[model samples]
Target: MTQVPTGETVTAAEFRLFKTRSFSRHFNRTLHISVYEIHRDHSNRQPELTLLDHESIQAGDEGWLVFDVTAASNHWLLNAKYNAGLRLYVENDEGQSIDPSLAGILGRRAPRSKQPFMVTFFQANRNQIRSTRAVKQLKKRQQKKHSDLPHPNKLPGVFDHVHVPDGRQVCKRHELYVSFRDLGWLDWVIAPQGYSAFYCEGECSFPLDSCMNATNHAILQSLVHLMKPESVPKACCAPTKLSATSVLYYDNNNNVILKKHRNMVVKSCGCH
Candidate 1:
């Protein structure tokens, strides 16, 4: 494993939820959620690395996640000799775990051109709000601002971050537009295959909700692309049941706290 550079702060990456497609409205309006990592060091007996959650509510029709890698690197796990690794988890307002049916999440590493992670765009609403017209308009504006760019891919800028376009707290329509440039680079290691539920194949034109195997296959493409072309991790595995010794609690001030107990173990399917 490559050694991470030692410093007061290693690179801080943000995995923001660039896009989401929600076919099942299970968490539609009632969704108040948090995204965080269950990270671990690279030792043979990999120890658990813990971090707080990035909380967000659905602003409009779309749900967004803005996860900070700095929180995961507080203990300097980023500098470990063996590559540090983590898995993503989503929790609801009630603190119960929610499945990927809620939304197919697409995560982009900040400040790097690394491939995006775990997305199906299963029931993605493309034509309605995030139409080609809107995307092109945004892209054209972005190109004008960044004229010197070589290959012009759609990039997110300050203008696209507007939650409320017309100054309304809630709007009838909402859309998200982003590019690889906006999300820079990854600070820590990620095992792409473990996040199978969140990915979809590039050639997968069919939406497979009924067939679990096909569904997993489609989404597995997202994580697979995260890895190099020569190394694609396993696409299928039985979901592991996590046993947590600590629970996430909120103080009187609504601050999140990791309430600990005796023993804790964190496991992801890949990159252990």
Candidate 2:
């Protein structure tokens, strides 16, 4: 319920208990803990709260106990204020003990460094590529006229925006060496001064074949576009395969540490 990733569904939530905490000799060294969600009153009073999930867990050698509060965490991610409270309970056949810390999620004012935290995991993949078959087919009236000439302003970076030299008409992978020093990134990147991060180039013409790595959907889409050129865009030349690049970067905080940024290389090209 604390400082979790928003927008994305929380896949898992972990609540940890650190340092000296004991249930009693009744349950030996183990404790049965149930985590619950607290919902605020829509009328702005205390709306309500409900039980999400629970588990019985034992402490480790380090006296650490981690409980999965994912069910509650996901609900909060939807409408955070909807589930506005936290209740931890210890239940046994003898009786159930409830600890209401209406204090709630990360937004609540809790003691610094002492507040119970939720370590949430999210399926966070920010980079998204449009599939080859994802071209939009527009209506004739909605289409507008455009020139075949290229844009006057040009810049170089990666993937589709790369420049294709004259005579290279077929879509294919091209060698492109990225120089960290030229970009003033050599201070962090300590390994090779540069690497050949290939980029895709050229055109996706009619009858897009396997040579261009065009799927059947792309082939049909291209054929449809020829009859109505203003309604759809042609397929783009872009990377279909990508591989990570290992770089030595220093995180010097007194001691030096090396880290790898695995997102800057493309391994293959395709019309997509």
Candidate 3:
């Protein structure tokens, strides 16, 4: 018989470890949990098999252990030469949280079902703009035929039908356009005058008067200009140059009218 250590004796069969890896080879994953208990001799001289926290398994760098029925037989006697009770938990690569579910699964209870959750994940890549070169080609073609652009007046007065969030009345149509200022990418056109609604397709929504307006329409145009047909939202079924005016305006007494006239002059002169 093998002599047990003074403080504890652990057999190889009581615990198991398993490992997984990231797709990019960036990280390694592992799981460790305890399986079963062992009885000691009638003298009770042996130490109990105290299962460490699940985090211990997660500490494995490359390989992990999975405790199966066969693995459970490998036991270490605590203090004495007999089998002992094993308690187990789970940990991740960081060995941070104690994963109880992982322990339960190892103990043979029904494993938790894996379900996909709905959340948007954003990844920033330096090459993202370069990857969108195809979109740029499409925009050039559209810009050359600017005369064919649809006039906003031709569209139905859908703005009247739009219900403002509050009892606010329809002020004026604020034209939203997409322009690439200093930024290499096209950004949403924000008006100095507040926006109450967005005129897209034939429907309109209210409360654009808030600080954070829906730039989705302008974003749709940029996407279309970039010829990224796939990125276009379904709500943006209107023509590329469709002019839907937002019915919201800021009233700084006479200052608003003077600003509007100044804008008209700038528009006529083709000034930026």
Candidate 4:
């Protein structure tokens, strides 16, 4: 276990050591919350960061050097963990050393979900930006053409409507998931701002029968219509660009529809 003095300057080597620590749920008395880099998932091109309790502090080059506040004493633990501009100390587990202050939490908040919102993990390449640029670019183009993509910025009651805890906006995308449980009045749950889709799976009470994989614009619109007269498509829908790999066909009325073949899963809503 590493010990950080209350007030001191931490060396570069010390900061590296402070970061590689692990986490232990059972702290002797109090626990100071800190962040450490672990791994990133290549499938979804997102980072996988975890918290480090006081006991897990050891020598390694993976985390940040931050002030150690007893978990019991800090009434703002939840808030601090999620808020920006927390202090960091660079030093060994014990002994006097230099402490440096840094901006915000170490890495983005890890993705968390409400009950019944199980994690459907996605992988990302080691070089996330390079690996996921196409998907992001495609979505960006779509958003540009169709300005009415459902987003938190446009939605009046984003936090209230989806049951996201207040003050959790600072949390990272990976650290949050939206809830649709008992939301029967919702004809459409627009994908939160910036994300490509919003999920409503796992034994939900809402009418999400047709929206099993609501990834693209067409599926989302279909979901709105699926709700029928009760549907309240709060956000407007726009014509989506279908991929070349998909075969386009016309229905009995000659309405163009995308074949149910490729399931393009883009970024989904998270705490951020």
| Predicted candidate 2 versus true structure: per-residue lDDT over 1-272, tens digit per residue | 33333443455666654323434444434445666666654675654667666665442222334566667666766665766656667644445442322111221243322235444444545632112111122112222123242111110110122223233566888889999899998887677788888888877764353457664455556545533345777678888888777777666553345555675788777776
| Superposed Cα RMSD, model 4 | 21.6
For TM-score, candidate 2 versus 4, the one ahead is 2
lDDT of all predictions: 0.34, 0.51, 0.29, 0.27
Q: What TM-score goes with each of the models? A: 0.31, 0.37, 0.18, 0.19
lDDT string for model 3 (1-272, tens) is 13221333222221333233323222234544434444442365654443343333332333334333322233322233543444444445655444543232322332211111111111233211111211011111111112243221111110112233234332333444432343332123234333222222222222121211224454234334222323543222222222234322335442322223212211111000
Candidate 4 lDDT trough over 10 residues, lowest sum = 128-137
> Which digits, one per residue and each the tens of the lDDT, describe model 1 over residues 213-235?
22334334423432222355423
| Alpha-carbon lDDT of model 1 | 0.34
In order of TM-score, best first, we have: 2, 1, 4, 3
Using lDDT as the measure, what is the rank order of every candidate, best first?
2, 1, 3, 4
Candidate 4 — which residues are off by over 4 angstroms? 1-59, 63-88, 101-272
Give the per-residue lDDT digits (tens) of candidate 4, residues 1-272. 01212332222111111232333322221223343333333466644544333333323223333322233112222243432322222333343332221211223232221111100111223311110100011111112123344432222111212212222322111222323334441233222222233231222111112222223453344234322313433222221222222334456675766553443332332110
Better of 2 and 3 by lDDT: 2
RMSD of each: 29.3, 20.4, 23.4, 21.6
Q: Which residue ranges in model 2 land beyond 4 Å of their true spot? A: 1-168, 252-255
How many pairs of residues collide in each model? 15, 3, 25, 30
